[model samples]
Every structure is written in C-alpha cells, then in structure tokens.
Target: MSVIDILVPAGDVRRMHLLVAERLAGKGHDVALVGTDAPGIARTLDNILHFERAALRIRLDSLLDAVPQPLLSLARSGAALRVDLTGSGRPVASPALAPRFAGSPSLAEAARLLMLGRLPDIAVVLDGGRPVAEASPMADSRLSVARGLDDILARVLTLLVIETHRYLDGGAMDARPAETAAPPKTPTSGQMVGTYMLSTVPRQIGGAARRLAFKLHRWNVQYRFHKGRRVADTGLMAGEPWLTLPDDGDRFYADPFPFEWNGRYFIFVEEFRHGGGKGVLSVAEVFRDGAPTVPRVILEEPYHLSYPQVFAHGGQIWMLPEGGAGGNLVLYRAESFPDRWVRHSVLVPGRQLFDSTLLEHDGRLWLFATERDGYGSASDMLVVYHAPALEGPWTPHQANPVRIDRAAARPGGRFVRVGDRLVLPVQDGTLEYGGALGLADLIELNETKVRLTEPVPILSPIRSTYPKIHTLNSSEHLETVDCIAPMLRGGLRRAG
Candidate 1:
C-alpha cells in the first residue's frame, strides 16, 4: 500500500482540507497532512473531531506531525502527494520575496516525477474567484468561506479523485506542472481577510420570490426543423410560426423528446401538475396536417419524472426518463407502443441522477447525466457511465463528470446524429438552472474519455411570447422544443 502526503493550510477552522485528507485516507492510503500556516494542523485526529468522524481522520493524521520530511520520502515511494493552499493567508507584497505561494516549486517537481511514476503526486490549486456575499466594503473578500464552500470542496475533491484515477489507468495526467512565474501578491496580515461568508440569506429570499413568481410562469413545447444541418448551416428560425402545445390550468409540459416510429411521429413530455408537485410522463402524436392529438398520460410514477428519452433498441422500444428525485435511473420498456409501459429495470440505483441519456456506438452503450454532488446547482457536472449492453454491469467513465461548466454541462434533450458528429441539446444554467438551451457536438467518445465541442446557442426563436426555451429534440420528420411563459395562478389567461 502506498502512503500519500497532503499539504494543507494551518489552523483551518472550516476543516475542508482535513475532510479531503480523510477522504483520501478512506481510499486505502496512509496520508500525512502537513500544515503550512501553523502547527495546529499537525494535531492528532482525536484532538480534532469527535469519535464519530474519527476513522478516516485517524488514518490521515497518523504521521501528521512528521512535518515536510515525509512529503519528500512519499514522493520517492510512488505515492500521491497533494498540496492544498485554499484558505491560506496571502503573501505580503515585497520586492525581494517571491509572490507565488510558498513551496510551489516543490509541487511542480513532484508533479513531473509523478507523471513519470517516479513519485506520484497531484497538486490542486483552488482558483478563488471574486468573493460572494459582501455586505460591507470592509468585509472579508477572499474566496474562502463562500456560501458554496461545501460544494466547492465536493467539486475539487471529485476532480482530484478523477484525475488520480486517470493517472492510475496509465492515461495522461491532467494535473500539469505549475508555471515558474511569480504568483500575484495579496494583502498583508494586517489587512482584513478578503474571504466571503457562506450565508443562505440570499438563496432564502430568492426562493420566496420564486414561489410567488411560480404562479405566473408555465412551460410549453415548441417545434422546428433543421434537416440534419449544423448550427452554422441551419441559420436562425426567424419569422417562423413556432408551434406550442395547449396549456392546462393545473399542469405544465416541458422536456419535449420527439422520435419517429415506423411511419408516425410522437413526442413524450413531462406533465408537471402544480397541486401535486409531481411530473407524469405523457405522449402526444403529431398529425401530418399540422394537428396534435390530445396527449395521453402514458407513464405515471409516485415520484417526479421528466425528459422521457425514448429509442428503439434490439427490436424493442425503451424509455429512460429523469427519475432523479427517486434516486435511481429508472428504465421502462414500451409494452404497448406509447400508452402501456412497464418498468424494465433500474440502470443505476441510489444516485440522484438527472436527465439520463443513452447513446449506442461502437458496440457499447453510453449513459449521460448531470449529477448533484454537493450544494451547488444540479447542472454543474456532466457524469457518464458505459456498458457492453443496455443491461448488465455499467462501469463509470474513467473521466467521470467529463465537464463541469454550469452553462453547458446538463443534458437538455435527445442526442441526434448528423453525419459523423452527434449533436446534443444542453442547458445553460449559469443564468438559471435550465434557463436557456444550446447545441454541442459530441466530438470524441470512448470508454476511457468523453469530449464535447463548444456549444452554439440555438432555438431562441424571434417573435415568440415564450422568451425562455431550454430543451430541444429532433427526428427525421419531426422536431420538438420547450419554453416557459407566464400563466395565471388559478386559471388560463388568454393572451391580450
């Protein structure tokens, strides 16, 4: 077994670095946590947390007091070493002193040796963006202690684990050596700490406002055609009469997934009722004469469901809808066309997976979804899993959460093939969760790695009352889109 060495800021009251060290120890590594700020970081686990969270902490703090000596030895043992400088004091600006974080040169050399397997080490630097939640000009303005601190830790640790696995798998390391340039100088010790505080006040206020505004907004479906053309080739849908499904007073429909079966066109959507606060999967047929049949409630679950991803596979039709709230990837096989469906199997259980999508290529089945790791938005990470068949054991992609951009990580609609490329609709949640939609081409996909090209915004149709659209899907002869528009609270208000 390899013993790993980790560096953390001294006197970290938040205990985030300690939590990360504990997690690493849980993965079967003897971890030595060295403190950079003060000597208290070298304290034993018993002196830190109570007995309940002590197992992993005990393992990480085993050699906590050995100082920087073990870090060099662990470097020679092919053990993973990580340097975490988050929540540390910034260097006072001086002409003679290097502005870079102290001991970063050692981190760079360790990373180079780690890549060569001479000594496996991974250094993580938290990019503290402009601090959030500043009530006063004199308030602490550092990136530490933000409202999403736990979420940030989750993301960084998750990335660390993924990158570690990548290196272990003989894949190229994503953690490159640090630059030789001097780091930027920060405020001195006397300066008020520039870190932000993590408070729920803003979110609480926002939530209450949203509850009030929910009375006015409802989602509706839209449709158009691209004829297999790329976004650059398929210009904007200007002056076109976008189609929409009629809205009911109690429910709203969204996550439109359209597919052509045999000779007919069908769309499956999420019908969310205001009273029950649960979504039921519904399907509607579109006629050639520009008319939509009354959508029939096809599948109903005790828990919420949305984004019914439907496709034909192995002489049978299958559906994998968003059952994230149920904490499972629920798959349903169409027993009787679009109406009668039965629960086939649960692909992944106990994971709060959102917008699960399947793609069959090169004799392998790929599953895509956005996972909520911590307290941040659910659209932050794009996780992937693959299997030899639709059923059976599914293996997580080595590079799980392949992307972490809030703007384009969430799956929005179906994945459509255009020539050699596969275009998938994705949600841009930086504005708001599922606030807008765009299209990204799946550039490279394999068992080990998955990559998506930059997304091009699409389907924001001009001259439409529904200003916000977030989901889009297409078939050979049929297309589907969804948008949010305001409706009266208790009754349908006709547009004046």
Candidate 2:
C-alpha cells in the first residue's frame, strides 16, 4: 500500500474532500488529508453558492459536513504522493501528483456554465501536470442552478475516486494531451451578481412555476418503425417516413430492440403504464405490409425492466433486459419464441447495471453497461465485463469503466456490424435523458483494453415534434427507434 495525501483548500474543506479520503483509505491505502491556503476567489465562489441555494430554495447536502475525528487525525503524516483537489496550480512538495486539473477549478467553471444555461464538460485530471484521465460527468439538466451544481459535483467526485483507484493500481491511463484552448474567463463578483439578478434568478422562478403547472402532464416514450431500410443502409440521416407504434392512452413504450428470428420479425420494448409505476418487457410482431400487432406483455418482475436485448445463441433465443432495480444482470431464455421466457442464469449479481448489452468478439462474450454505485447519474460510466460463454463466470475489465461520457456512454440499442466496422448506438443525455441519438465506432476491444471513437451525431429532436429520440435498432427489412414527448394526464396527447 502507498501513503497518499489528498490536498484540499484550508478553511474550505467540504464533505467531498472527506469522502475522497475515505474511499482511498477503504482501498487499503495510507491516506492523509492536507490543507493548503486557498485563493481569494474561493470565498467568492462559496458565497455565490450560498446565495443561490437560499434564493432557489434548493435543498442540497451540506458541503460543510464535519469530518470524522479519526480521519481528521491523519493529517500531515508526510506522504510521498498526493492528489490535489485544491484547484490551485501551485507546485506540490510531494514527489508525485497523480491527478489534478490544469485550469480553473471544475466547480467554479461548472457554476459559470449553469449561469450561461449550458452543460459543463467533465473535468480532466493530470499526472505530473500532464493530462492523464478524463470522462464526461452526468447531471440532470432540468434542475435549478444550486441543485445542478450539487449533481455535477457528486458525479465529479465519483470520477475522481475511480481515477484514484486506477492510478494506484498501475493501470494504463489515457495519455491524450489537454485541450490547448484556454477555458472561458472566470466570471467576476460583479458579473456574477449582475447575471444572477438580471437573468438566472427570474428564469429559475419562472421555470419552477411552469414545471408545477405541468406536474400532471407526463412525458411518454413511443417507438417508430420504418420498412425497406436495413440497419446498414441507415447512415447519419433523419426525416425518414417512420411509422409510429401506437400506444393506448394508459401506457407508453420505449427502448425498441428489433430482431429477426427465422422468417418472422419482431420489435421488443419496455411497456410502462402510468399507474403501474414500473416497466415490463413487451414485444410486437411486424407484418410484411408495414403494420404492427399490438405489443403484448412478455415478461414482468417485481422490479422494473427495460431494454430487451434479444438474440439467438446455442440454437435457442435469449433475452437480456435491463434489471438495474433488481441489482443483478440476468439472462432469460425463450421456452417459446417471442412469448414464454424463463430465467436462464444470473450473469452478474448484486449490482445496479443499466442497459446491459452483449457482444461476441475474440471468442468471448463482452457485456457493456453503465453502473450506478449508489450516487451520481447512471448514464455516464461505461463498464465492461467478459466471459467465455453466456453463463457462469464473468470478469470485469481491468479498466472497469472503459469510458465515462454522458453523451455516448449509455447503450441505446443493439450493436450494428457493418462489414469491418462495429457501430454502437448511444444515448446523448448531456442535455436531457434520451435527448438525442449518436453512433460510435468501436475501434478496439479485448480482454485488457477497449477503445471507441467519438460518437457522430445521427438523430435529434431539433425541428421535430418529439422532444427526445434515444433508441435505434434494425433488422433485415425494418428499422426501429423510440422517442419521448409530453402527454397530458388521463391519456390525452399533445402536439409539440
């Protein structure tokens, strides 16, 4: 175990700092908390946070939570390595610094982004003052400024904890250079005060009132299908004459996964009823005349289910729908095709895994999903697990969360293979959950390493009636997608 020191601003230590120290210590490291004098701007930032919380009535976990006396006693024990959270770019006295940002602190910049009505990019960390690790953190876009700040900070803290573990394990870190362009100028005290007074405060109040007015209106997801377009033929284009899979006034459908079995085609989805309050797996058969039968419930559980990833293997059909709420990765086998399914095996147990997807490559089955470790958005961290077969033992990748990006981390639909290239359907949740869809090229995948090209924009809700379009999949003759829009209570639809 290595003796590591976490450096934070003196007289400004927050709960996040203590949380980091506790996590490092839990990993069997000798950890110390070191306090350094902070810049004067830190006080201004704190005051701004306080003002926003009171003005917006945002109830956030106090950042000033007191640290345990035992942990606080580990201060200044002379550790050789340090992790800097101070946002001060000063040279540290330690022999090594694993991860620190090069520019203004992430929190300050994030608050500025919120003021500008924009999403903040995930913070990048550096080793020896060189860029080493970076991933997109996820936050709810529909929150007040104070609440949004808290959400982003929580996700950033999770990312830091993961990176710290990787650093100590001698794992391979991304060696990419930091972006050369300087970040936007930090807002001055006068600018902050003026903007909050003239813009942010009023906008937030109006937004809150509007939300309350629409509280009874529910956001519903619906699936769309198009014929004569195979998965390979549909490139980065929109405006196809897609047919909407009609839903009853009571329920909605989403996460469409299209599959071709034998000579029949089917589309599986998550059918969620307003009163049920949870989703169940459902499937609809598509006829050759471009019509779909009513989707019927195929599977239900005590907990929620969605994203029915159906495929054929070992001469039998199997479905792996997301069971994140159940805290396990389960496989279901079709006793009767497109209908009866029974539990096959528990591939993974006791974990909150979302949108788990399987890919067969290099003679192994690779599973990809975003993990929720009791905090932060489940849409940011892309983790990998692989096994030789469908059941039994599965091992997590060395770089567990191979990617951390809100724009493309969550799996939207089935993987499409076009000749030599593999395209991954990804959910762009930077602005809103399922706000758009993008396709990422899988560059490499193996037992030890995984790489993916940045996602290219494909479909979005811009200039469209739908507010969000997330899932995308296709069979030989039909392509499928799902989108979200608001519907009035009691099953009345609204035209956007």
Candidate 3:
C-alpha cells in the first residue's frame, strides 16, 4: 500500500479526517489526522492516527481576528493576493509574509507557510492562493470520493482560509458553475418585495391564503443525470468529465414526490423536457403511494422552475417554485388540475433563494433556502424564514443564515423531523462530484444544528448506463455551442 502524508489543519471538518481515515483505512492506508485539540474528534477506522497540538488556524485567527478589515492585515496573516471584502465583506489583510509564491498555480507553498513556516521543495510551493478552486462559474473539475472529516478546529481553520480566499483573496478557490445562461427574466413580485426571496410574505395578503399557500408541501421533481453524450463512464477512469456517457444521446428522466394534496398524495415534479430547457415545473397524477404516473406541466415559467413545494390550506393547492432572481417567494394556486397554476402573491421576496423548502415546527412555519449573491453556489449557506400564518406576515430567523457548507450545502431531496429533532438531508456540491447525501440536526423552529457539520463525500462517479454531458442554458442557444437543432442532450431537446 502506498502511504501518502496528507497535510491538513487539525480542526477542520470540511477536511474531515475521521471519515477520511475510515475511507483510507478501507483502501489500506495509514491515515493520520493532525490538528489543534478542540471540541470534537472521532475514529471510525483502525488505520488512523490523531496528532493534536497548537495548530495553524488558531495562530492565524488569533493574529487576524483583532486586526479589523484591512488589506495590510492579510499580508501579515500569510496571504499573497489580498482581496479585501471586509468593508462589504472583510477587507483587512496582513502583508509582509514574504511573497515566495509569486506566480505558482498550487497552494502548497501558501499552505506550508501557514503551517510550518517553511516546507520542503515540493511541500511548500505557492500557486495562485485559490482558497476554493471549484468557485469558478464555468471551470468544471471536481474531487469526488465515495464516502466522507476530521478536526473540529480543522474545519474552523479551513473556513478561515476558505472565507479568506473567497471574500479576501477573491475566489482563489471558487466552484465551477454547474449550469449556466438562462436569460435574465423579469422577476415578478408576488406582492412582497425585497429584491429576492427569503421565506416571508407581505402583510397585504390574506390569512387563509397564507395558511393554504405556505403550508408544508412536498412536490416531485425530475433529476436528470448524464442526459447526453457517451464515453466509458463519461471519462470515469480518470476524474475527467462528470457526465458518464459521451457517445450516447440524452434521456427522459422523472420522479414523483408524494405531497398532501387535498388530503391525498399528489405527485409533482419537473416534467421530462425533450426540447425545453432545464428549469420547468409541473404536476401530475399522484400514484397510489405518491409516485409519479404521467407528469404534465401545470405551470411553466421563462426561467428554470424546479423543486415544487406544495401544500393545501382552505381547500386550495398552493405552490412555490425555486424562484431565482424573483425576490419574495411567490405563491401559486392551481386554477385547475395538472394544467392551470395561477400566480398568487409573494411568500418571501428580494433575497436570492435557490432551493426553498418549507415545514412547520413548534407552532411556527419554517422555510429553508440557500441564499447568496447568486445561484449555483446554493449549497454553501442556508437561510431560514418563518411565519405565523402562511401568508399574513413572514419573518427571517434571528440567525438567518443558519449554516455554511461547501459540501452538502444545497438542500437535498427533503427535510424531515425525525423523532424530536429536525433532520435535513442536503447535497454536497463539490463542483462536479459527490451528489451524495448528508444529514443534519435541526435544533428548533429557527435554529439549525448539523451533524458531521461539513460536506461529506457520499457518491462518486461510476460508469453509468445513462447518457451524461447534459448542459441546459435557457438564455443561450444551441447554435451558439455548435449543436444541431434536433440534437437531444441531457434530456433537453430543441423547442419546435
């Protein structure tokens, strides 16, 4: 077995060393987790070692925390390319760390400089100091492991570096855009307005509408993977392409989610679009067990409409789409079955809520969403909005953004309260790897507690029988990318 000395800070959970130890042990490697001793640590494998001490993150945090937001502070904290967002983000940076990593592409030197002062030739080489490489809007490369951290402090410490790179270093480590280019739509304000959607509705609406509109409802959506192209597992031998088959055509994918529809299970999801774009929403027959039968588009918007959250109150089927730039999560009531969905008022608005899920706990209705300056990066942070009645008036949690994760950052499948605690399963968006599942503990009405606390690697790219290489751009035309009009890729076909 080849043993590699993997260097990582002690307290970082995203750097999950315990699970890494288990994974490495299963693969026959002596995994060592080294970091400063902190709150929590564990071992799930036999071939693991833990080295705890005064780690690098603490040293850096201690040095930088009090310095305030300034570019010069970054130089002192062992950074080269200082991009301060502290004023708007955190601008304070330290200087005079010695610019040894002048023009490198790897973070080796910068990492080494932060930990051991000086590293070996290969050990310490500085690249562009990208805190997160996957942050790029279009660059698609990923590190997908089958299963997933370590150091409690290692997680905290890594966050320091990560936040530094993002807000401080200016996306030195950014994620590649998963899907792109739907022409900006005229954001329809469902009444309440704030720019984007958060989870609350305006007071101008009715109470019955609020209750019926905002009640916890589950809707099915199609998850189309590897829709087009064909290759050996979509270039899986090496972590090359995420889409599995490059030689094959596209696919028609659909799934059913059982939701309480007039005291019955109604299957709702994004219908399989052959020529239409990726962002379409629809509802169809709710199978005996709430499975999808034949999905028909009840509602279609200009942008990508997905993750339908449906509920019934006051004898009306209310729906909420994963509203994009349209602020204030809007309310939709079915004007008819499987065909007419009328746009009502707003539920939450003016905030960027990519995947907004709702539920009621402790006499209060809670809405979950991934908020940021944009989309695609929805999994990293979570925003919770609450209300007394579904439509009366909504309020954001005191602790609005409850969680931040690069892994399992986006709301996956659904959120359920198991037993006494709230459980949320989310997807860890690792650029193009590990669409795996993760679990977290929802403390209460507005508070969120996470288990494993970081993005855990669940699924890895395996040679699949499905067509891969699916790219959906509503605003962009296929002619622009050199594809035939009738060409079917990733389940998206040219509209007639």
Candidate 4:
C-alpha cells in the first residue's frame, strides 16, 4: 500500500490510468503507471505496475522529444513512487512535458508535487473522453509558479501567470502585489480561485502569432490540468480569471458589475443606450478605463436605471439604483463620476427586482435578490436587512424567503473577499443570461441572520453570445428582424 507514480502525456490515451489503477487497487495502494502506452493495456491492470516507457510526440516537430524518460518501467516493477501527470487517454504525449519530473527539479516543482500530496488528489485532463485540465502547481510561498500565474498562487502571482498568461488580456496589466491585503480591504497578500478550466479557443485567435500558437497548446493544458483550490477558513485563495472581453466594447458592453470601493476598484455597468427606454449607467474605474470621467445619465425609466447597488460607508459613496422612474430603491452620493452620482434616498417600493446585490455580513446588511415573477422567466430571492448603521433603522431578516432558486439561484455581482471568506457572486438561473457563477458556502452573517454553506455552481452555462448576451444592442438588430426564432431544444427558433 502507498505506492503511486503517474505521468502519461497522451501515452495512455484514455484508459485514464485504468480508472486510476482501479482506484488504487481498491485502496490497498500500489499503482506505478508511466507513459507512452499501446501494450495489452498495461498487462491488463491488477495492482497496475506497468511502465511501458516511450515519451515524446505531440508534433511540434516532436518538440525535441519533450525530453525525460528515466526510471522507466517503474524500476523494473519495484514500484515505490507516487506521481501522476493526469490526462490519461494519451495523445497529449507532451502536454508541455506533462508535470515534468522524469527527475523533476522545477516544472514548478514538477507541477507542485504532481498535485498536493497525491492519491489522485487531482490531474484529470481528458478530452474526447471528457475532462479537460485539472492542473495544479502555481504555488504561493512568498511566490513560485516559477513566478506568478493565475493568482491564488496564494502569497502572490497576480493574474494568470504562465499557463500562457491565461489566454492573454492584460490590457491594463498592473502588478500591484507588495503582498497586498494589509488594509487593501484586509488583504494581506493575494490569492484567488473559485473554479476554473475553460478552453475552446478560435473565435478570435488569429493574431499575435496565432495567439502564441494556441498558447503552446494552452500552456501544456494549463500547466497540467489547472489547480489552485484552497478554501476552508478562507485565508484567501481563489480567482475566476477570464476576460478577452473587449470587442471594441461589443457595440456597447453590458454586464460588468464587480465592486469593492474605498479600497479602490469599481465596475457598475449596463451600457446599451441605442433606443427604446434608453440605457447607460456605465462607469469603469477598474485600474482606469476610458469614458468614465464620472458623468453619465440617459436612464429615463420605463425600465432602465438598471442593476446597481454601490457602497462605501462612513466616508460616504453609497448607491442603491434600480430601474427608478417610480420603480424604487434610488439613493446616490458620489458627487463626481462613479458617474457623478448625487441624488440620495429612494430605498424600496417598485421595480421589485431585475438585479440587486449588496452584502454587509455578520453584523448584518445583506440583500441578494432577483425578480421578474411576472414571467420574464427567472425567480430567485434572498433579502434580509438589519441596520443600526449603513444609514437606517433598517430591519427585515425574519428569514424573508431566503431562496427560491430558478436553477442555480440568480443574483450575480458584488460582495467580494477571499480570506475572511464572504463572497456572493451567484447566477446560474435555470438557463441563461450570465447564468452560472455560484458560491455561497456556509455564509451565516448575523443581523437578519442568514445562512448558507452550499451554493456551488462556479460559472456554468456558457454558450458565448459574448457571454450570453443580456442585450448589448441585441447583436446589432439581427438583420432588422424579419422572422425566425421558434426553435426550443436547439434554441432561437422564432419567425413572427
């Protein structure tokens, strides 16, 4: 028992390590499966122990044979190792030299000891057989992923470092990381991860050397099956990295909302303004983007002030915005461009909900709601209040319908923090509309006393209409609409 060693870069091809050496020989442990397969399926399984050894051949002209073939056939079947480079149906052959360690010294410590103290802890990158990357080894010990890569590298590492700089989009690439978190809203050094793994490329990968040649086969399948998960007491460790978003503002961007004021960071979006009731509550000072000098207003309101809830407390800067014009929840106060702000006082009474996210936690100030019960097709609610502060005698956490879930329970935006834990960003609503980005986990903040130790769904349903179109000029009028849209199971099938 206790003898494992794996590193099959498309060398095995899909027996995926015989379901992991038949579940580690049913826990009696003793598996040792090296790469480059083709033999009668590793001598037909049993405590495993195969070592067929061959390594090298994913076609980049054999990539100098992706070097490394030592200790082949597991020391002639003596088996006393525990290494697994994941991806087991073979074909990856050189998934960037799989987690390295034919005698490893650094493929980021051989992809972080294969994956945190092993036992199939992870590294399952499959393909036609399913899985597609579960790599891990960007560490954060003061720093080391060779050096930064998709934050949550714990101690530091900024944005998607290595892993081919995660599909590239530094656009405003700032380093910042002096070990952050010391009043950086209680940061104390960076770390982020809530769920990751996405690659379908080609929608636009024809520049920058064919996007770095598909980013070297996407950084050897994201440095060997992407991994950085760490969340128990939430000492911070998670980042949802993904953003190629910038198709020249895709005819006027829409869903953006992500906040954390006073400490510095803001998004507050919704920007269409082409016609009808009009729209535009845009503001993007996230490391500074243009067109946001703080003056924007074109929200008339038959249905448009749209999903905003801004907050900063004590020093000022508070907002509640929703589709006003007598729909309710107004309150504003920036005086200059988080879009100038100003007006102040509306809080409750109309436009019941199209989006509203705000959380104060523990001492209490929660409100994560979503409505259109009128059959706009979506229903999710979680509202509770309790204020001796945040301006009000506020009260309403008598367990006021904390959930109704329309699939993954809507409400996606705002409420951020990883170390002290408290994160909300939800949305997996029954089907679409930015649906899939959940994570609630044992929340329990006081006041209206709310609870949640399970909300899961980390960013699902992505059919990509540039992130499931929430109406950014409706794809430029769709040919002036003449007919066609009545399909149900295959989507968009109308013709009226």
Query: Which candidate's TM-score is highest?
Result: 2
Candidate order by decreasing lDDT: 2, 1, 3, 4
**What TM-score, over all chains together, does every model reach?**
0.70, 0.85, 0.45, 0.27
In terms of lDDT, model 1 sits at 0.58
lDDT of 2 by residue, 160-267 (tens): 777777767786766454466665356676776676677677777777775554433333433334545543345543545567788876777888888888777898
Clashing residue pairs in candidate 1 are 100-183, 140-194, 141-194, 141-195, 142-194, 142-195, 222-481
Deviating ranges (above 4 Å) for candidate 3: 1-251, 254-256, 260-265, 272-275, 286-292, 325-328, 431-434, 444-496
Pick by lDDT: which candidate is best?
A: 2
Candidate 4 lDDT tens digits, 1-496: 4444444444432332343444445556655556544331222221111110111111121101223343334322444433334423234322121221212212222223222221111122111122222322211111121111111121011101111122121222222222322221110111111000011012112223433432111000000011233221232213333232231211233444445554545555555532344455665443322223332342334556655556667778676755634455566778864556666665555545555666665565655565432212233444555666554556556654454443334555555565666666455433323433456654576754567655565431243222221211001101000000112222222221
| lDDT of each residue in 1-496, candidate 3, tens digit only | 4232223223333323333334444555443433322322122111111111121111212111122221111012222333221111111223201111212212222222212212111111112232232221110111100111111122222233333323332333333322343331222223112311221112212423533443211111222122232111122212223221111132232322345444443445544343455646655453333243555567677666766666666677787767665555778887875467898888876777866776776777777776653322344566677788878477777654455555545565445433554555555443332233455555445334323344223222454322222111100100000011233323333332
- Backbone-clash count (model 1): 7
How close is each model in CA RMSD to the real structure?
10.5, 3.8, 21.9, 21.9
Where is model 1 poorest over a 10-residue stretch in terms of lDDT? 132-141
- Residues 93-188 of candidate 1 have per-residue lDDT tens digits of 110011011223122222122212121112233222121111100001111122222233345455555443333345533333335555533323
